[model samples]
Target: MPLIPKSHPRAKSLLIREKLVKGFDNGLVAKEGLLAQGRGEAFDYLLGEKTTKSAKKAIRAAAAQILLAERPVISINGNIAALCPKEIVKLSKQTKAKLEVNLFYANKNRKQAIIKILKKSGAKVVLGSNISTSTKLPRIDSARRVVDKNGIFVADVVVVPLEDGDRTIALRKAGKTVITFDLNPLSRTSQTANITIVDNVTRAIDLLIYDSKKLSKKNHSSLRKIVDDFDNKKNLSENILEIRKNLTRGAKIA
Candidate 1:
């Protein structure tokens, strides 16, 4: 597809859809991922497709958590693997975190497809197919209930971009620090996560990678301080306020 001019009415939205279509063709995106993207797109549109200040703070905190963890694992799902394969791989390597695949709609073919995509993106290890070593996450009835023993199950911290709500709650209950990129601040995933980044996944992941690298040289105490200082509720409140303010301003104009 040729690049759409920035002046086009729906340039950004079209481009995002284009990427998803390509991902579907590559088998990296599930059929349901398209619907998930639609839901996310609506939220993104509400945010004006812009990363707010609160979202950046959440990203920074998320980075600190990943860096401070003894074992950090980056959990990738169909949407994320299709959307930010290279950046996700980069983050895993940069933070020395394990790259793992966890799917909502589990299937051998889709799982393998995500793994192939990650490997092609330079990921050496993508851990999803170890049902023999599956560990249960409590209170989740979805496919997310199962995770790899060496991956998310044992990690001190997990970066789960575009996560489902129940799994977010379950991981937290399991004592793993959870970081999520969710555009909707009100969603259970965002409110329950230790660090909720209310931003587009593409933008949020890159920012997180940048922050992780910059914070990598800092001492452990400093990284821990950053994490400790973060308040997920306050950050999410700020995001909601911004959304409300924008909506109010639009209403006044109308």
Candidate 2:
């Protein structure tokens, strides 16, 4: 990776790209993951490259849901492992949520690479490595359907950052509450998820961890109220409006 000057206008974005490129070289990210990151980056630009109020609300609700859940699992992919492995591990510890590596482009070496990163980041037990213990998710044919029986398969709530659409729908059908971080509010993964934080995962993940810690001290009923008060569709609509506002503002600036 090249040296990215902190004073550079797109410093954060540039650093994220470099990280993904390095992850690809390290076998922690697939070739397709680079392309996916590009798409999400475009949306992040539209979002003004910051976490919005709607995103914060969704993050709080997601945190509450995780705390209230009997079994909550955070599904990690190659990009997540490369980008924020330490934050992921912290959130897992804070929320007591299980960490499971699930990928669309699944391979043994890639899986091992991700697990190695997570463990190095202080994760004690990362699931989804052994195929013998894996179970198939209903209504999805993608490689992401192969889930560890003790993790996602049994989880009451799932935190899937940078997730695909079909699996979000499938998880819902399987009777699990799905929470996701997506830059594009209009994407299927954003729309289908029970709680969608339409923000950059790198930024929103830390907030989720913070909220998880704060909400953990509250009673179950208080946490339940936060979850009950959230409306995913409404929040998504607000995020869309935010994009429209940003476009209009940019046009005016031009």
Candidate 3:
């Protein structure tokens, strides 16, 4: 990977790309994960590559939801492992959420590689590697359905960053509050999740951790109120409007 200068217009985005490429080379990210990153990058560009006000609201709600959950699990995949492993570990510690390595492109080698990254990043016990203890999530055929019984299988709230649509819907049907990070506000994962942070995961994840810690000082009733006041559909609509505004602003400049 080449050194990205701070003066580069797309320095942060370029750095993220380089990280994913390095991850693929290191066997931490799959080939498909590279394609997924490109798709997300397009949406991030539309979002002005920054966290919006609506995204901050959604992040607060997601933090409240996670804090209020009886069992909260942060699901990990190749992209997430490659992008924000340390932040995820810190979040797990802050919110007492369990870290589980769940992947759409599941395989033994990839699973071990993700687990190793998480462990190195300070995650003590990563789940989703034990086949014997794993159980199927109903109504999903993807390899992501295989969840550890102690982790996502029993979680009341799940934070699935860069998640798939099918698993989000399936998790909702199973009566879990799903919080997801998806840059595409129009994606199924965005629409179906209980709280959708329509921001780049790399940017929004640290905010989630900060919010979780701040909200921790509040009582359960306060946390519940925050979650109750949020509406995912409405927030997504606001995000779409924001995108339109960004495009309009850019058009004027051009």
Candidate 4:
């Protein structure tokens, strides 16, 4: 299908629907793809396609972390581009993070799609991946097989938008800090990320950017410790229990 006209009034929705098609083809996505889309749309609406309180915190923390890094790379995937290409570009400017395409379905066409959107949004970084992309820094994991790359590889921080567990593991092994957005706190991506914002991407990204605008060059060492201290499994269980408890109380009230 032709690329959706980004300038058009319905461009955002059109892109969202198209990415859903690509997401299903990628196959690693959750089984409830349609349901997820509906939920994300609702979240985008609630957020007014802008920032939220929690998301604002997340963005500030993320930008501060990246700014502290000697090398920061923002990993852009199809879903991220489709959802918030403009914001992604803004983030690249804010954090000085290189925009790189790292998706489950890495290919020529996919790279082109990523580049098209980023460039359209005025992001300066060229197309690149774990396998082949021009970088003075050495390649760590080519062919997308390895769990991690080893070296002072030019990315101390990696913002993995729309990520999963496998690559998140790789980033950890590489000693690179990861910031992610995940609604299902139980997912591996959320569990492994150094900073996990448990919310929809549109809301999360906007908040992060908003905070990015306000945050200075100061580091967030204390916040990093908090994030590290939180256990993924425990956090997920707590979230689930809270939801269940609230639902049970609501049932009693009814």
Task: List, residue by residue over 3-105, the lDDT tens digit for candidate 2.
Answer: 9999999999999999999899999999999999999999999989999999999999999999999999999999999899999999999888999999999
lDDT of 3 by residue, 1-254 (tens): 89899999999999999999999987889899999899999989888899999999999999999999889999999989998999999999999999998888888998899999999999999998987899999999999889999999999999999999999999999999899999999999999999999999999999998999999999999999999999999999999998999999999999
Better of 1 and 3 by lDDT: 3
lDDT (10s digit) by residue, model 1, range 84-169: 89999999999999988898988888899999989999999889787788887777899888888898889999988889888999
Backbone N/Cα/C clashes per model: 0, 0, 0, 1
Number of clashes found in candidate 4? 1
Say which candidate scores most in lDDT: 2
List the candidate 1 regions with Cα displacement exceeding 4 Å.
Answer: none
| Better model by lDDT: candidate 2 vs candidate 4 | 2
Worst 10 residues of 3 by lDDT: 101-110
TM-scores, one per candidate: 0.96, 0.99, 0.98, 0.68
Q: Sorted on TM-score, highest at the top, how do the candidates line up?
A: 2, 3, 1, 4
Sort order, lDDT high to low: 2, 3, 1, 4
lDDT of each: 0.88, 0.95, 0.93, 0.63
The stretch of ten residues in a row with the least summed lDDT in candidate 4 is 143-152
Positional deviation of residue 10's Cα in model 2 after best superposition, in angstroms: 0.8
Candidate 4 clashing pairs, residues 3+ apart or interchain: 59-208
Writing each residue's lDDT as its tens digit, candidate 4 over 1-254 gives 56777688767666667766765464322345456577556534433444434444555566567666667777776667666789889988886777776545556666676677789899876446344434332233543332123212457888887676777777787677888877655667778888766666765777677666666443477545534454545544554554455567767989
Q: For candidate 4, what is the TM-score?
A: 0.68
lDDT of 4 at 251: 75
Point out the worst 10-residue segment of candidate 2 by lDDT: 208-217
